[model samples]
Target chain A: MDRRNNRRDAEGSSVITANRLLDGRIVWLAADGQWSPHIRNARVYSNVEIEDALKEQTASAQDNELVGVYGVQVSLSPTGPVPVTSRECIRAGGPSVHPDFTPEWQERPAVSPA
Target chain B: MSHAPHSSLPVGHYAYDEVDRTFLKQRVAQFRDQVERRISGALTEEEFKPLRLMNGLYLQLHAYMLRVAIPYGVLNSGQMRTLAQIAQRYDRDYGHFTTRQNIQFNWIKLEDTPDILALLADADMHALQTSGNCIRNVTADQFAGAAADEVIDPRIHAEILRQWSTLHPEFTFLPRKFKIAISGSPQDRVAARFHDIGLMARKDENGRAVFEVYVGGGLGRTPIVGVKLRDDLPEEDLIAYLEAILRVYNEFGRRDNIYKARIKILVQALGVQEFRNRVNAEFVAMDRARYRLDEKIVAAIQARFGVPDFDPAGQAAEKLIQQRKADRAFDFWVRTNTHAHKQPGYVSVTISCKPAGGIPGDVTSAQMNLLADLADQLSFGELRITHLQNVVLGHVRQDKLYALWQTLDQNGLGTANVGFISDIVACPGLDYCALANARSIPIAQKLSERFASPELQREIGPLRLNISGCINACGHHHAGHIGILGVDKRGEEAFQITLGGAADQDTVSIGQIIGAAMSEDETVDAIARIIDTYLARRTAGEQFIDTCRRLGTAPFKDAAYAPA
Candidate 1:
């Protein structure tokens, strides 16, 4: 799987799209719309093997998918909008934003039964 | 004449908002259903335990104790009035506000629980997470945003954590109970360091909010200070980091042995670093898609808890000084009873519940109602539950000090010994609590009676006498200057005394038990004997604690154990 996209790159380019799970091994998300996990120099794309193995998530997909990271991250901006942290924010401590999983992503059974 | 205490101050920080009303109605219906199911035996004791706990019902010595969550320790007159109604109707004419910023009614019957929950729900309150092995009522510095000396409003962070941890899926069944405390002020009046997880808000070089996280600290069989997990956690990673630690504890903490199940024992066994590594590892694996702490939500919450419109109409500090100069008692009260507030015209006034020869932290139903009324009148309807187990009215104006003092004095609450020796913290031992080995209230009463005179208490200076009936230490005996522990010697109740312990910013030391255990009468005589010895030997202005440290416990030990 293309794990490099998960790593912070100094160049900060949009490369390697879609989340790919390989042989029930590891999970990795892409940096862009590409379904693969491969990148050449600064240019990144879905790896040929990964693209061949997996299908597209959805037609209208964004840059990154949080397939691997555990908790959500909200960045702090000096002049931008600040986040809410109290119980009032959550009607009763539920998720702030519900991510819509693609049908394919939702249909996929667990690699191992949980 | 109101049975409840009265105040001349104006009420503050209150609103009967729409959201609160909706939630209250919903919770009441839910609880009413649960109570009916319980009565019908559809819900067994085991099945109903978690549900009842969430509603703050505990099966204690005589009956159930309904602990109503007082979020961040802020309450107005209306809420207090509701509490009084509950106490009068369901309980035995009283309620106890605990160190955790919650109020407990000890004599609640299971049958009346649904109605009690309904009452609390009407007041925009719930008893959720007040007890049981779950994320408890999130506690913060009671003064919070209002205290002038605060670095940041810790309540904001406290509120955030409360939302994050409430009904958290994986952590519902932990090895043992967990406690989290946060403070925005450098001078931690909340005693954050001694908690299971302590968060202190600090500023980095960039002047952004960062948290100093302390982990694996708690008080019980073993008392220990929390080790620093992160000196400066970036504001963004607060929830993620906390999730990581909790996940690790839930999965790996010991469950077979109840006593050794706390995260503290696991931390001690695995060592802090190893525990940290496991937490980080679990944190890294948590599916990020499901975890979302959004910017918009944070802003919305902050907006709701915005600073009150505070007006500095009068110079309270100057007036206080003038009053202190005119009246020596008022001067003493100002010095000992008042705490500095962040706002210019406001001060936090502590109404001592440690009445002479009475139980510490025990407020009658009438007194509670009065305090609630006083809160609505004198202060901005804002009250505080201190870790010392005393009640406080923050945001008191200087111009109203004399009038407030007069009212408090008329009530049994005006002890005027805030930081002094007589202001003690004693657990309800054999008289009320099931876990107690001996009676603690008697010892506390004896000491209170001996030092009941205000002049004598002042002469003794600031000292803490914490007494616990058993080693469970609900009374916090280890932190007292003269810690008295009641041990069962064979079948007889015996007292083991310790000296030179202090829970202050600069010092934290468990007291050393001196000599053999004494019988109940001898224990009081022994304490009286020790105090007499301190009085005879102490240098000028030397408090009981300083003298104990100087002379060591040797002299006291010799005298305490010797024949009377």
Candidate 2:
């Protein structure tokens, strides 16, 4: 999906994210155009491509897949894209107290559509 | 439930009339359609924010939270059962009772909310006006009908306010949210003085009901006491007088800056005397007949809430002597959690949700179900949510107290700390709230666990400790004897300490800041040190606030920041 809208304006990377409309589960824009629950599988986009990613995912939002779509600033590591701010990290991770419901913190999944 | 399937309205609770039921049904259907539209590609989620807020659906950090209004903190077993079912089915297994006499389920789905709301409507409850910049829930004394010192029942008046403010078109979009609290008793158990509009019920020279109205008193970043707008506004003119004040605020309250938007800011900007003059002028020009609170209407509402039949010759506290002697734990629980009732042989029992290290204001569905059954069996099937984030089972017979205590003790509900130091009120904070700068529950848990001893709490006497995640002061930190405010200090969570605040009937003062903010651990230690200072300085039978006021916060502040 990123190949179709491959445009990079800056070196810095970010991921498009939103909460699913029905249950409000946090999801990230996967490389295959699906909103994946795990953030590690999201396709990281550059500043210019963020707009394309948002426009592409807006169809999903229009189709009632997810809502409140926005780009979260992230840092690219060998593992995956990590959230930059504390609030986004908390959004990526569950509540500090309730760790049982949180996803694996350091676990990595399918790589972005490089 | 054993006796009936709720075919009859429970005693001491208001039953919905046909019009109320029909309106609720139509509102639910409309909300259902709205949710459907948002999902079916007609309206985007961003577009649905304002619409959802009117129906009490707020988007928090992780998920959506639904706040259901418990008007004046009054509900029956049937309502409690519905809340339990919703908590168990739609969201998590628990629901949080808020400081404003409402219940909130944290992890709600947007799709399931309509069903949850319909269930609430069946119980004669709704989430209407629970959110948004409108008139929020009108809180009142939890023990309104049962308090021994109550001069007038405030529930009828609160119900009247609920009816008037449900969908007032003019006031729907205020500069900011508005909160009003009413205290039925002379003792001001509901912290009426800290609300946007405070009404204290009293009788005139002829023994007819009247009120002392206080305007623009609120707690936030700028905490201020409400100014007295009227000394003795006649009961019949209650609605009219409130309209006058709200109209003045709607007209002159600042809207350009959100920080300066609360009525308190307006009241402070114009000064008390000038603001009072303007409100009085508005009152003089109002259409009198439309807003006149008819005694017949009040009587009708009062009749709907049928008075609980109390035994004239009921045995008093002497009946519990043997039982108290037998069970020491029950004795402490009774002393701390129960209060004097207007009835001769009954008492109002406070079921404190603050266990040793449990979450404040959180009750699991199982506990809710049990409490509902117990209320039906023992306490007239009525429940109340207090300002301090505890539940009240009002009007329990002295003889049946042991049975109630046993059931609560078996569950985790028997915490023997009602107004004690450990019965802390903490907001949802960063864990659930999107606006919080720090977490409040962990601090509350640490404090409650550190001060878990019943004997120590009894020794400390009465103390109100509150923590707010942000400066919004939802936890009423401004009114606590010892207050903890969570702030973002250079990206790290820090707690600010305040001393010498009290929101009771006798005293109403905002706390004074003590030095700089501290870390979470430092905050816990500072509170402990403050308590130690109080314990050392307090005279015989003097409470924490009295000691703080008598010596001022200088000594406590010194102790808090002293070498340690």
Candidate 3:
């Protein structure tokens, strides 16, 4: 199981961070659902890409290559160099943004590789 | 927990039978597949949103909300159990039953939604079109077939609309969402006039089922009672008439701005007569021969929803009545909380969600299970969710009243304040809603606390208090006897008070804002002052509205506005 070629595992998916304009301000969600400008250059990969990446793993790497892949959909502020792959976006309009509560208040789970 | 054997899922919506268990299985699988696709990114967000919405999953505030429709507010034991399971397993161990005949589970994750949908589908329920701009859950008199004043069962029409609107290809993408309500009863408790389309069941000259159609009425921004578009439309043309209206709305509605997109705005902009004519033209152009509902189809749906059989003898309930009379609490509940049923042995039971100063419409998972059991054992597997956010066991026997009341009391739903002052309707204003300017639940809670004394509320007589976070009016402030609308003034939250609005059969008046905005604390004081003035000015036996009308806003205006 080559790390990049194991299908059904979330790790092989590209790590993409999304920058969104919500009510005129840019914000994003961390792996823990916290929103801050500090954590820079986070990336995520979609399930499809992860699956494709896993399929290419050869027999030589079957046992020791990919133990488990974890995947999560995330959001972030639109600034700095964030490793963002456009494919893994879950909520296109940003992570269920609300007018009342800040992104930090939301408790989102880290994308665990399935 | 005891459970029935798994049943086969039905192939199509039309295959649903009252006794059929299999259809639930297939429907759950279908919705589950849709959910998986959405999560897997196989479907685009745009594509997935509608799919999720149809299954009652809404991405709101912090998490996904699953709104399960209780068609015509009817729910049985097994269905309730399913909801309870979803609450415990997927949601925040609680669900909120909405003013419309539906329940919303907040705090659900996107990945777990498919499993929730599967659970609901197991109970023969789904959250179809509960949100997102489409025909909403068809509401009817909660006491529909059971109410004594009902001319005919409104559920039949509701079912018809449900079928017509389910994945309706043509009207799916409307300018804005739509809501249709029907009532067979003359009491008008469902507030049909406030819906996008209100259908009142009546008989024509030939003594056949004819629908009286009303259009352009809604609660948001410009609230107007639906004007009579057609006095007596034959039963066969029901779907056609609805189609005509939808087509007219789709064609002429303003889509540039979301606020002006509702059909009500279109109707208002075009004028009622012009709107009616446009709809009429569309109706005439419609291929009557193709869309005309077949008698067989109507009969099939009607067969599943026909009134439940009940014994007319008063012998069963009479003993319970006597027993209840001995207990003061139960007696009070029986007198005010229960409603008259068409059947002598049966009665309509109101499950009040408003208790002292609690959040309206919320029910714990434990309560959901109890309600389901109660509906099964006592109410013949039938329940109704009222527009007032209370669940009604529509056909409870009088003998079961005491036991039911005790259960409801233990569950925190036994408030003898159905239509009393403390039973207020408030939206999830600034707390959760994106559109809210100020908080509504706090104002509602304050009002409820101020009028917490049951005796005081009883003395106040029938009063409706509706609060909206913003002008969007989700709480339906415009229809309340005393309405409170929240506004954001400068950088601070302010409340504007309105008076003399009523959502009843005889008259429906929009409450006019009395004066300038007041701070949250000052708002409560102002409301208390107005109530004080009404109490002082009212003639004996005159209710809040009657007093307001007699003295007018002049008297209350000065008190509410003076130095506030």
Best by lDDT: 2
Candidate 1 lDDT by residue in tens digits, B25-76: 8877887888677666566555776788878886643346688987667666
Query: How good is the docking of model 2, by CAPRI class?
Result: acceptable
Model 2, residue A74: C-alpha shift (Å): 4.4
lDDT winner between 2 and 3, please give it: 2
Quote the lDDT for B338 in model 2.
91
lDDT, residue B166, candidate 3:
74
Ranking under DockQ, best-scoring first? Answer: 2, 3, 1
Candidate 3 CAPRI grade: incorrect
| lDDT ranking from best candidate downward | 2, 3, 1
* Residue runs of model 3 more than 4 Å from their true location after superposition: A1-114, B1-51, B294-296, B316-321, B562-564
Candidate 3 predicts chain B with a TM-score of 0.92
Model 1 interface RMSD, in angstroms?
A: 26.2
Backbone atom clashes (below 3 Å) for every candidate: 23, 0, 34
Candidate 3 local lDDT, B1-564, one digit each (tens):
111112232111122565444555666677778766644546655676677676676655334567888776666666777887777776556777777878887667666766666666666777777877788888888887778888878877787898778778988888999999898866787777788888888876775688878888888888788788988888888899899999999999999999899888999999988998899899999899787776777777765553455656557677876777689878877877888888887788888888887777778888887887777677666567788888888777777778888888887989888888888888766555545677777777778889988778777888999889889898899999999999967435799999988878568778898888888889898888888888888899999999988888999988787674
At residue A62, give the lDDT of candidate 2: 64
Each candidate's iRMS in angstroms?
A: 26.2, 10.4, 14.5
Instruction: Provide the RMSD of all predictions against the true structure, rounded to 1 decimal.
Output: 22.6, 5.5, 10.1
lDDT over C-alpha atoms for residue B500 of model 2: 82
